[model samples]
Target chain A: MKEIATYVERTFESVPDSQRKSEIMQEIIERLEDSAGKLEQDGKAREDAINKAIVDFGNLDEILQELRGQETGKGKALSSLWFAVIGSLLVIALTVFINLYYSPGVVWFLYPTFAVIWWPLCIFFFGKWRKGR
Target chain B: MVSSDLLRGHLETILLRLIGETDRYGYELFSEIDGRAGGRLVVKEATLYAVLQRLERQGYITSYQGDVSGGSKRRYYHMTPLGKANLEQGIREWHEAQEIINIFLRGNIQ
Candidate 1:
C-alpha cells in the first residue's frame, strides 16, 4: 500500500497541474486502499495484500478511465450551460438593438429569435463539447 | 444450460435487479448473484467491474463510498430510477430476441 501510494505520488509529481493531479491521485489511492483492505480482511497478510494490490494495479489505465469519465461529464455540462446563457444574452441584446433602431414591436420577436438562434448555437457547442470530451 | 450470450444477459439483469433491491458493494453484489443463479453463473471480477463502470457512465446506476471499518471503505452501487426503466427495456428486448432465436433453433415452423 505504501509503495502504491509512493508510485501514485511520483507520477503525480510529473504532472504540470498540481490540483488536477492531486484529484486524480486521490481517487487512485482510494481505490488501491479499498482493494488492499479487502485482501487483508480475506486473511492475507498485510504485506501480501499490499503486494497483490500494487501488482494488480500495475498500470493506471482503470483509474485514468474513471477520471476521464468524470472530467468529460463536468466539461460538457459546464460548456453547454455557459454557452446557452451567453447565447440567450446575445439574442436579447440583438432584439433590444433592433427595437431601439426601428420599432418596439420587434420585442414580440424576441422569443422566436432566441429559439432559432439558441438551438443551433446549443447544438454546435454540444457537438464540439462531445468531441472534445 | 444457458448459452454464454444468454448467460451474459442473465448476469446483467441479475446485477441490475439486485442493486435495485439494495445498494451493495462489489463483493456483496457477487454473493447475491451467486445465490440467485444457484451457483450456475458467476461473473469474473474484471468483467463485473467493467459492467458496473459502464452502467454508471450510462447513468443507469450510481455509487458512493460507504463507511470505513477496520481500514476498508466500500463503494456501494445502486440502481437509479433510469436504471429501473433501462432494465425493463433490456428485459423486454432480450425476451424478444430470445424468442426469435429459440424458434429457429427449435425448428418450430408455423
Candidate 2:
C-alpha cells in the first residue's frame, strides 16, 4: 500500500499543483489501497496484491493522457512552446514596424527583440524546467 | 466481453445506469462494474476518471467528497436529473440497436 501510494503520487507529480489535483491523487491512492486490500482478502500475497493493483491502474502515459483530458491546467511544455511561438511572432511584427518606421537601415530590430523576447522566455523556460522536477 | 474501444462509447450510459439506483464512490462503482461483467470487462482507473470528469462536466452527474477510506477521502458520484433523462434516451437507443442487430443475425427467415 505504501509503495502504491508513492507510485501514485509520483504519477501525479507533473499535474500542476492544485487542490483538485491533490484530491484526485489521494483518490487514486485510496483506490489502489482498496484494490490491494481486496486482493489480499482473496488470498494474494501483499506484494503480489500491490503489484496487481498498480498494473491494473495502467501505465503512466495512459494515466497522464486521461488526466490531461480532465485537467484544465494544460501541459507546461506545450504552453511554453506556444508562448515562445506567439512571442516570436509578436516580436517579429514589432521589429518590422519599428524598422520600417524608423529606417534603421539594418535589421537592428533583431537585437532588441532578441533581448526583449529571449531573456524573459529563457528565464521562464528555465524556471519551468527546473520546477518540473 | 466488449472491447475497450467499444466500451469507451457506452461508458457514460453505463455510469448513468450504475448510479441510477444508488450513488457510489469511484472504487466501488468501478469494482461493481467489473464484477457485474463477470470479469470479462474492466475499466482502467485512469480512464474511469476521465469519463467521470466528462460526465460531471456535462452536468450528467455531480461528485462530492465522502468518508475516508484507506487513509484518504473518497469521491462519490450521483447522477443528475439531466442524467436520468439521458439514461432513458440511451436505453431506448440501445433497445433499437439490439432489435436491429437481432434481426440481422436472424437473417431473411421471415
Candidate 3:
C-alpha cells in the first residue's frame, strides 16, 4: 500500500492544504488498499493486485480539478466579501469627506454610513449561512 | 461500455439508492456499483468521489469511521432522510423521463 499512499500524495500535491484535503487523501488511500486487498484474496499476487488497483482507480486529474475548483470557489466568495467591505469603506470615506468638507455642522454622513455598512454585513451573514448549509 | 456522459447525470441517484440500501464504505460502494453494472459501466474513481463529496455537502449523506478486521478503519457512508427523499424524487423524474423518451423513440409524436 506504500505505492498507493505515494500515488495519492503525488496526486493531491497540488491541492491547497486543508483539513478536508487530508481527510480525502486518507480516504482514497484506504479505499485503494481495500480494493487491492480484495484482489489479493481473489488469488492475485500482491504486486499484481496493487498494480491493478491503481490502474482501476482511474485518473486523478479530474478529482484534482474538482477539489481545486471547490477551493477556488471558497476563495472567490471570501475575496468578494473583502471587496464589498473595501468598497463600502471607500464609499463611507467619500461620504465623510463630502460631509466634513461641505457641511461639518449638520453631520449627515451617519445616514449613508449606516446604509453602506449593511453591504458587507449582508455578505458576511450570507456567507455564514451558505457555509452552514 | 456505456458512455460516462450518459451515466453522469444519474450517478447521484444511483449512489444514493445504493447507500440507502445499507451503509457502505468507499470500496464496497465502488465494487457494488461495478458489480451491479455488470461491466457495462465504468465509473471512474474520481467521479465517484466527486459525487460523494457533493452529496455529502448537500446534506444527502453522512459518513463515519468504522472498525474493520485488520485493525484499520474505513469510512462508511449512510444516507440521510434528505437523501432518501431526493432518491424518491429522482426515481419519479427518471420514470417521467423514460416515458417521454420512449414516446419519442416509438414515433408517437401525437
Candidate 4:
C-alpha cells in the first residue's frame, strides 16, 4: 500500500496544478487500496494484488486532455482580460495626453468619446462570454 | 452480454445515474457500478475518475469532501440539475440512435 501510494504521489506530482494533482492522487491511492483489499480477501498475495492493480491502472490520456483543456481555457481568459484592461487604459491615456498637450478644447469630450468607442466593445465581449458560457 | 461500445455507453449511463442518486466517493461509486453491472463491466479506477472530473467540469456534477472518522476523507460527487436534464436528453438520443441501428440491422433500412 505504501508502495502504491508512493507511486501515485510521484505520478500526480508530475502533473501541474498542485491542488488538483494532489486531489487526483489521493483518490487514486484510495481506490487502489480498496481494490487491493478486495483482492487480498479473495486469497491473492499482497504483492500480486498490488502488481496487478498497478499494471491494470488503465490510460491517463483523458486526464491529460482535461488538464490541457483547463489550462488553455484559463490562459485564454486571462489573456483576454489583460488585453481588455490594457486596451481601455491605453485609449483613456492617449485621449488624456492629446487633450493636455495637443488640444485643450477637446478635454470635455475625451471620456465621452472613449465611452462611445469602448462601451460597444466591452458589451460585445461580455455578450460573447455570456453566450459561450 | 454487451459489445465494448455498448458497454461503454452503459458505463456513461451508470455514472450519470449514480450521481443522480446521491453524492458518492470515487471508490464507493466504483463499487456501485461494479455491483450494478453484475460482473459484466468493470470500470477501471483511472477511467472512472477521469470521466467524473469531466462530468463535473461540464456542469453535470459537483464534488465535495466528506469525513469518515476511521477512514480517509472521501471526495463525494453529486449530480447537478443540469446533469439530470442532460442525462434525460442523452437517454432519449441514445434510444433514438439505437432504434435506427436496430432497424438497419433488421433489414428495415428501406
Candidate 5:
C-alpha cells in the first residue's frame, strides 16, 4: 500500500501543482490500493499484485496530455476574450481622449463606444460557442 | 478485444449508466466494467478518470468521499438528474444507430 502511494506521488511529480492535481493523485492512489488488495486476495503474491496493479493503471502520460489539453483549451478561450476586452477598452480610451481634447463641446465618443462594445461581446459569444462544441 | 477507439464514443454513456445504477468508487466502477465485459474489454484507468472528470465538470455527475472498512476513504461518484437525462438521450441515439447499422449488416437496404 505504501509502495502504491509512493508510486502515485512519483508519477504526479511531472504534473503542475494544483488542487485538482492533488485530488486526482489521491483518488488514483486509493483506487490502486483497492485493486492491489483485491489481487492479493485472489491469491497472487503481494509483490506481483502491486506490480500488476501498477501495470494495469496504464500510462500517466496519456492522462497528463488530456489534462493539459483541457487546460490549454480553456485558457486559450478565456485569454482571447480578455484580449478583446482589453483591446476594446484601449480603443475606447483613445477615442474618449481625442474627443475630449479636440471637440470638448461635442459628445460623439458614445457612438464609437457602442461599436467598441461589440468586440468583447462577439468574443464572449464565440468563447461560449467554442466551449459548447 | 474491443478497440478503444470504438469504445470511446460510448464510454461516457456506459459510465453514466453504471453510475446511474448505483454510486461506486473508482476501483469498483472499473471492476464492474471489466466483469461485465468478461475481460473482453479493458478501459485504462487514465481514460476512465478523464471521462469521469469530464462528466463531473459537465454537471452530469457528482462525487463525495465515503468511508470504507480499515478506516480508509474512497471517492464515490453519483449520477445527477442531468446525467439521467443524458443517459436516456444516449440510449435513444444508440438504438437508432443500431437499427440503421443493422440494415446494412443484414443486407436489408434497398
Candidate 6:
C-alpha cells in the first residue's frame, strides 16, 4: 500500500493541478489494488503481489509528458487572457487611486465599473459571436 | 518473451483491436493485454496512458467515467469510428508488410 501510494504521489508530482492529479492517482491506485488483489487470490502473498503490481504497472513519465502538454496547450491561451485582465485591472486601480487622491471622488466609480464590468461582457459576447460564426 | 520494445510499435494496433470488441476500463485494458500475451508483454502504464492520450487527441478514442459498484470511478475508453477505420488501414498495411517479410524470411528473396 505504502509502495503504491508513494509511487502514485511521486508520479503525480510532475503532473499539475491537485484535482486532476488526485483523480489520476486515485484511478491508478484503484487499478493497482484490483490487480494486486487478483494476484493475492491467485496464491501470491499480499506484499509480493502489491510489489509485483507496481512493477508491472510501469512508470508514469510518459503520462506526465502528455499531461504537461495538455497543461501548456490550454495554459498558453488562458495565460494571455489573464495577463490582459491583470494589466487592465492594475491601470484601472492606478487611475482610481489618482482620482481618489487628487479630486476626492466625483465619477471615479466609472473607472472600476467599466474596467471590471463592461470589458468582460464585451469579451463574453464577442466570444459567443465568434463561436456563432 | 516478447520485449516491450517490440510491443511498443504495435500498441496502437493492439489497442484498436481490443477496444474494437468492447469498451474497456484502464485496469482491465492492461490486464487483457497481459493475459492475451501470456504474460510476456507487460505494458508500462505510462506508455499505455500516453497512447490513450494520443488516441483521444487524434479522435480515435473517447473516454468516460464508469460508476462501478465501489465508489471509485474508472475511466473507460471506447474506440471511435475513426479509430476503427484507422485500424482497418493498419491491418491492411501490416498484412502487406507481413507478406514481404515472410518472403524474405523464407529465403525466397534476398
lDDT of 4 at B65: 83
Question: Which pairs clash in the backbone of model 3?
Answer: none
Please provide, for model 1 over A13-102, each residue's C-alpha lDDT reduced to its tens digit, 9 standing for 90 to 100: 533544434644665576667789999999999989987876665555444455456556567866777777777777778777877678
lDDT of 5 at A7: 88
lDDT of 2 by residue, B9-101 (tens): 788899899988899887777789889998888688777776777787678999898886656667889999999999999999888988998
In order, candidate lDDTs are 0.71, 0.79, 0.87, 0.75, 0.87, 0.78
Using all chains and alpha carbons, the TM-scores for the candidates as numbered come to: 0.50, 0.64, 0.70, 0.68, 0.71, 0.64
What digit string (tens of lDDT, one per residue) describes model 2 on residues A12-125? 788767766677777777777878999999999999999998888865565455556655444665676677768777878988898988986776777777676774577567
Clashing pairs in 6: none
Q: Which is the leading candidate under lDDT?
A: 3
| Chain B TM-score for the candidates in order | 0.81, 0.89, 0.92, 0.83, 0.92, 0.89
TM-score of chain A of each: 0.41, 0.52, 0.53, 0.49, 0.52, 0.49
The regions of model 3 sitting more than 4 angstroms off are A34-52, A65-71, A78-82, A85-133, B107-110
For model 3, the local distance difference test gives 0.87
Clashes of each: 0, 0, 0, 0, 0, 0
Q: How do the residues B5-106 of candidate 6 rate in per-residue lDDT, one tens digit apiece? A: 866778988898899999997767877998988988878776787788778877898888887757777888999999999999988988898899787687
Tens digits of per-residue lDDT for model 1, B13-73: 6679889888988767866776877877655544566567667877889888789855766
DockQ of all candidate complexes = 0.10, 0.31, 0.39, 0.46, 0.41, 0.45
lDDT of each residue in A1-133, candidate 5, tens digit only:
7998898888778777877778888778877888899999999999999999888888777666555665677778889889999999999999999999999999999999999999999999988887788
DockQ of 2: 0.31
At residue B69, what lDDT does model 3 achieve? 53
Fnat of each prediction?
A: 0.00, 0.52, 0.66, 0.66, 0.62, 0.79
